[model samples]
Target: MTFDHNPRILFLYGSLRDRSYSRLLAEEAARIIAAFGAEVRFFDPHELPIYGSVPDTHPKVQELRELSIWSEGQVWSSPELHGQISAVMKNQIDWIPLSLGAVRPTQGRTLAVMQVSGGSQSFNAVNTLRILGRWMRMFTIPNQSSVAKAYEQFHDDGTMKDSSYHDRVIDVMEELYKFTILLRGQADELCDRYSERKQKGVQESMSDIGRMVNNVNLSQM
Candidate 1:
């Protein structure tokens, strides 16, 4: 099936520092995806409270959930800290539940993982992101970006400098766009499961019984 609207993509980055390379990388990916005719948005983690620190009704939490539901694809850029994805990145993912009421926010959505490292190259952050994506039931693209010495990868303007790492980011975004276009149109079919169908059937039965009971009480009155 064909889609008329542009593919919406959301970006999440780790680190809230004055000059965050992870954010820069995510912005760069957003630009590339936008150029490829995809709509892109970023979730600023600055004012976002830690997971469970505030109720889900908090403004930032609501914003994050709304964005997740709005996007057909997502890119997660995290800084490798202590040989793992930063807490900031994990917290953002934590806020986005696997299911929001009747809606599965991330299920069947395309995902691309990227990471920026302070020292030598490491895939720890991206690997961890891939696991999280799977847990969220998202279809993570095979291509990923891991930039080492991230400080030197971007210029003073926060734009990525022309290099192999930059090229990989572009490749990842392209792959993500393709995957989203291919999958978003078929998400319902792809995510359909017998377990959920059975649960829905049970709920319908319960509702029908409740209505019948209410009608009987009204007749007695």
Candidate 2:
């Protein structure tokens, strides 16, 4: 199958600091993907409430869900904090449900994970995101970028300087774009599972049995 339109990608970043390196990294990736002829968008987590603190009807939550459903792929950028992904990033992922009433919003989508470290280079954040991507049933690209000493990597203009780290970011974005294009039209066939289909059939059978039993009981009354 062929894709008729540009690949839509939604980016999520971890951090709310005035000069958040993770957000800057996401911005840089967005620019690269956009240049590659993909539609890119980022979600601002500043106003997003904690996962359980508010109902899903909240404007920010709704917006996030809507974007997730609209995109054919995603980019997740997080800061390495205390040997793990930042809470800001986790909260955003938490708000996105694994399954929304039989519709897996994220399943079969392409994902690319990236991270920025304040102290030294570490894959902690990106590694964690890869795990989340798998749990969400997304096809995470193999290439990932981890920027060390993030503060020094970006210039005062909030753009990454010319360095190997920037090159890695480009590599990752290129891989994501390729994967998104290849899998966008084949997602349904690729994600279909015989086990899930069998389970659904069993559930429908049980429901029918229950209805039949109720009808028999009512006739005797």
Candidate 3:
């Protein structure tokens, strides 16, 4: 399918540290995607309330949902902590519901996963994110990035230092942009499922029965 507008990409980073390398990496990816002619936005997890702690009407929750709905693709960057993806990352993902009534916010979107490691590079975080992306029904790209010794890879100003790691981020973002372009206008047909269609048909039938029942009751009254 073709798109008449620039692709919309949302970036989510895991880390609350003052010098969070995950956030820095996401920022670098954002710059790359923007240069690729995509419109990008970032969700600051610090402003978000813990999942299940607040109602959906909460400002941060609403903001996140709105962004997800607006985005055609996403980038998830998390730090590897204790040989796994950080809880901060999990919490952010948790806040995004798998479905909102009949609308699936994340389904059919393109996803790119990245991770930052304090020590030697590891794919733990990205691997976990890929699983989550699959669970969310996203079309995750084959390319990913895992930055080793993340502290040494980013400057004090949060800009990524010149290195192969930086190059990988650009590659990931480029792939994401291309995927977003390919998937944007086709998401509905691409995500369509027979099961969901059957379920919806059942629901509509039940609704029609309910209305009929109510009308009969009113006539009897």
* CA lDDT of each prediction against the hidden true structure: 0.93, 0.92, 0.90
In model 1, the runs with Cα more than 4 Å from the true position are: 202-221
Stretch of 10 with least lDDT, candidate 2: 201-210
Give the distance in Å from residue 130's predicted Cα in candidate 2 to where it truly belongs.
Answer: 0.7
Model 3 off-target regions past 4 Å? Answer: 202-221
The Cα RMSD in angstroms, rounded to one decimal, for candidate 2 relative to the true structure is 8.8
Candidate 1 is scored at a TM of 0.89
Give model 3's TM-score versus the native structure: 0.88
* Deviation (Å) of 221 in candidate 1: 66
For model 3, residues 1-221, the per-residue Cα lDDT tens digits are 44578899999999999889999999999998999898999998887888898888999888888899888899999999998998888988887888998788899999999999989979989999999999999999999999999989988888999999998989999999888887767888988775776677756655765688777856556
Q: Which candidate is the best by TM-score?
A: 2
Of candidate 3, the 10-residue stretch with the lowest lDDT total is 201-210
Colliding residue pairs in candidate 3: none
Residues 1-221, model 1: lDDT tens digits: 46889999999999999899999999999999999999999999989998999999999999999999999999999999999999999999999998877898899899999999999999999999999999999999999999999999888999999999999999999999999988867988998875776677756665765688777866557
Residue-wise lDDT of candidate 2 within 20-73, one digit each (tens)? 999999999999999999999889999999989998999999999989999999
Q: What shift in Å separates residue 161 of candidate 2 from its native position after superposition? A: 0.5
